[model samples]
Target chain A: MSFINVLSREINCKIVYYGPGLCGKTTNLQYIYNKTNPDAKGKMISLATETERTLFFDFLPLALGEIRGFKTRFHLYTVPGQVFYDASRKLILKGVDGVVFVADSQIARTEANLESLENLRTNLAEQGYSLDKLPYVIQYNKRDMPSVAPVEELRELLNPNKVPDFEGVASTGVGVFETLKAVAKLVLTEVKRQAG
Target chain B: MATEPKRVFGSLEELMTNPQMVMYEEEFNQIQAIVVRLVKEANARVVFVIDKNGQEIAKAGETDQLDTTSLASLTAGNIAATGGMAKLLRENEFTTQFHEGERANIHIQIVGNRVILVVIFDSKTSLGLVRLRVKKASEELNSIFEALLRKVQDPNRETPFAEITDDDIDNLFND
Candidate 1:
């Protein structure tokens, strides 16, 4: 859910980075946190287990400058992609405004990506939301890996709806901003259409 | 805007366009003041008035060492997990939670069934004193948010983003 504070003249939207475990969801957040100008970002928090796998989620609050008189703030979150963390994933999607599915591109992880997308659909459905209708995008991540699936194959499996999608190596920041920008645009556009 | 639980959206367009939370400047300042006073009275290190959706509406106290953005998100998750537990146990909601650390502790309270108030303190204050102060603060905070919800639902209220254009949003990413 987007929080539009007329008093502060700010728009706060929640965007979740979701995918299977170790699909670089956290990495996408870390890269954005590292690259964002200090003034434009808040503290990036990661609730991870001892081994560095995200136990619950990672959060990064970003200021995307102002459009007109209202400042736009996007709260970026990443769910624990491990399958057992289904409950945690559901909690994170409570008021989500947009979603960026960061799919692991390695050939071996295709099934995991598909399962995670299906999980996203079910969880959103439980919340009275449909992934088909939400402001959504896909990032074919880990594109730098040698065994990465062909973009065509990844799209055939993940981009059935043909939503705005990108290929990225989140660790190095490639296509990270593009992916974020695409979803952010869609969200703002949705807000505009709704606010009218 | 009146918190009508059964209100129909009419169509997906209505559902997709409606914002979940709205705050006016005057009310935000009022809530901010309450948070500031709560911090002083409770002798807490930091106090956060966050929407249950994990948005930090207002904050007070020394937050330099604190990652309040993360704190707000985690607190909401913690509360939601507890709420889920409450459902499983056939209870309405837990409403309050506290986690005691060796040196610092956290006290969380749900207010108005919409927002969560979290107080982080250490030896600087006792739990009893914090609880007493929060009880009063929560009541005040609850009323403020109630009014906020009503105002947000007002159909006549002006929306600042109504004038935003695609070109304007694109400009933000230009840099």
Candidate 2:
């Protein structure tokens, strides 16, 4: 949930990055952590297995300036994308203010992406949340990969609702901020909508 | 206070069902006071409160040497993991956790099932003493947050976000 601190003039919101295994969910967070100014970011914490796969989640907190004099902090998290990590994935979404579904565009990973999407919907539903109602965006990551599917095909599969979607190579940082900014804007807009 | 079954929801439901976890200045001061007192009463190095989602609500004591943001996030994860295990074991909720180190230790308690109360201590205090202090502090903190929730539910409460415009949001990322 969004934590609005009137005494501190700050707003903290959670945004979760989710997708299939090897979909570059952690990569997106790493890129953001690296590029963020030292002052605006907290230390990035990754709870990973010995193999470097996210065992639980990856967390990065960023202060993206202010809105109407309130400092805005977004705690960005990425679920371990492996199928067996469904429980961990569900936990990461506990207080999410927004979501970025980072679909690996490779032709071979389409099924994994769809399964993860369905898992997202069901897990969200269990928490009394509907994906259709949350501030959400989609990113077709790994656009630079040779075996990736066409953006059009990926959109038909994942972006049928046509939320703001980006073509990203998260490791290389292309479309990273665009996807983040889109969801962050949507989340703030959502909080504004609630404010009224 | 009658115990209510805990229901976890994300921001969407949190906004629609209850208000966002909006902290009023009045409630903030009360919470800060409780935290400050708890540190001294328990002979602890640090005492902080966080939402189940890992947002640091308030804290007091020797925190200058701590990365509280990371600490807050990981603590939540630890609780979430344990809470999952609780479910698998058919328990209502674990509600309390303790981890001991040679020099520093932690005690986590789920307060009213809404927030996590964490105390970090050292060899200076006994676990029994910390637990007693936390139990008393949890009740007080719970009442304050309960009042804060009710205050936020008032539809007419003034929020700075109400005046924020689309342009204002856009300008934040203009760089």
Candidate 3:
């Protein structure tokens, strides 16, 4: 749910980074937060367990740039991917304008990826949103892993809609901004479509 | 802003997905006026009108020292979490939340079941006064938003993004 403040000349949108546990969703946000210019980003807030697993969500607000004259601010968030946190994930998607499903590319996590994808669809549906209609993208993260599945395999399993998928090693920031830009672009384009 | 799942208007997709809330210049001033007036009537240190999604629509009173962006996000999260709790207990919604701090207290109200109205104050005012003022402010805010929504959904109305070009979007990533 993007908020367009005509008086303020600001467009605020929410994008959620979602995947199974330990798929580098937090790392993806951390990388973006670390590399972004201070003026472009706000404080990154993480609600996590003592061991650093995301407990609720991680929020990073970015002022990407102006679209025409409206300030395009994207609130980047990552859900706690642990299965039991389903309730939390649903809460975060309430007003989402875009989605990035960060898949762990390791062969061992293939089932987890599929299950999380199903969960994502279910949660979005609960909020009156469908994955196909939303501005959604997929990232095959952890490409540096030795046991990673081939990109072709990840695609066949994850990118059923073929929505601007990317290959990323989030720790090193590979494909991080590419994924962000891809989904953010889709979000803006969708906003325009809604207006038209 | 309403914690309840939206009641579909035309298509469920066209319902909530399009413009969840549109802030035009007209209603913006009315809403701002209510927020500003609430601060004075409630004797609040600060007042913020935030949508359920955490976008700060308007604010007044002393806010120079606050991290409003972060506060907006966290407040939405707080409301959503409590909304979740309400569901499990089989309640309609928990429309009001109060958090007392030693120095500054926070009062959050769900107005018209659509937006969050937050008032931050200290020892200068009583909760009774704040609540009474918020009740009046919430009614005014609700009517203004209802009008804004009616204007937004009118098929002939202009869209803020209608004038945006492909170049404008591409330029966003040019950095």
Candidate 4:
């Protein structure tokens, strides 16, 4: 859900990054946090375990400039992608304005990607949100890896709706901003539509 | 406008996502004043009023050392987790939570079930004093938000975003 505050002249939206275990969901957030200007970004918080694996979620508040005098602020969060973390994943999706599914591009993890996608759909449905209706995008992460699955294969399996998919190497910042920009644009467009 | 009887509360998500829950500048100032006063009365280092979706609506007191953005997000998450637990236990909702650290303590409570109020303090004051002050502040805030919601729900009120165009939204990301 997006909070359009007329008093503060600010629009706050929540966007969650979700995928299977170790699919670079957190990397996407860390890359954005590292690249964003200090003034444009707030402290990045990660609720993780001793091994630095995200236990619950990772949150980063970003100011993506303004629209028609209203500051556009996006709260970027990443759900713990491990299979056992389904409960936590459902919690993070509550009131989400947009979603970016970060799929691991490695050929070996294809099944994990598909399972996680199904999980995402089920979890979203539980909250009365349909993936087909929400502002959603897919990111084929770890694209730089030598054994990564071909883009066509990944899309064939994951991008059934063809909702603005991107090829990304999150660790190196490749295609990171493009993915963020794509999702943010869609979310803002949704906001406009809702207002009308 | 006719004033409807106010219910006990609704989910934070429902209140926040409602297009009618508009906050005007005048009402915001009133809320800020309440928070500022609460900070003084509680003798706390900081007080933050945040939407349940993790957006900071207003804050006061010493926040330079704090990462309020992250704090707000974490606080909401904590509240949500607790609320979930409450549901599983067949309770209405756990509207209040307190976490005490060695040096600082955090007091969190749901106001009007729409926003979370967080008070961060240290040894300067005891938890009892903070609780007493917060009780009074929550009541005032509840009424303020109640009026604001009624104003927002007024059918004749103007919507600032009503004039926004698709191009206007597209232009926002041109950078």
* DockQ of all models, two decimals each: 0.48, 0.51, 0.51, 0.36
Candidate 2, residues B25-129, lDDT tens digits: the string is 889999999999999999999999998899999999999999999999999999999989999999978999999999999999999878899999999999999
Docking tier of model 4: it is acceptable
| Candidate numbers, best lDDT first, in rank order | 2, 3, 1, 4
Q: Residue by residue across A1-196, what tens digits does model 4's lDDT show?
A: 6777787788889999999999998999999999989999988889999999999999999999977788889999999989998878888988788999999999999999999999999998777677888889999999888899999999999998889999999999988899999899898877766554
Task: State the interface C-alpha RMSD of candidate 2.
Answer: 3.6
Q: After superposition, how far is residue A15 of candidate 4 from its true place, in Å?
A: 0.7
- Report how far residue B93 has shifted in candidate 1, in Å: 1.9
TM-score of each: 0.89, 0.95, 0.95, 0.91
What are the chain B TM-scores of all models? Answer: 0.87, 0.89, 0.89, 0.87
Per-residue lDDT for B61-150 in model 3, tens only?
A: 999998888898899999999999999999978999999989999999998767899999999999999999999998888888778878
Model 3, span A1-196: residue lDDT tens: 7788888888888999999999999999999999999999999999999999999899999998887789999999999999999999999988888999999999999999999999998888877677888889999999999999999989998997788999999999999999999999999887877776
Per-residue lDDT for A122 in model 1?
Answer: 88
Cα-lDDT of candidate 4: 0.86
Error of 3 at B26 (Å): 0.9
Q: Candidate 4: which pairs clash? A: A1-A95
lDDT of 1 by residue, B12-104 (tens): 644533446778788988999999999999999999898887888999898887788878887888898888889889998998899999999
lDDT of each: 0.88, 0.90, 0.89, 0.86
Query: What TM-scores does chain A show, candidate by candidate in order?
Result: 0.99, 0.99, 0.98, 0.99
Model 4: DockQ score: 0.36
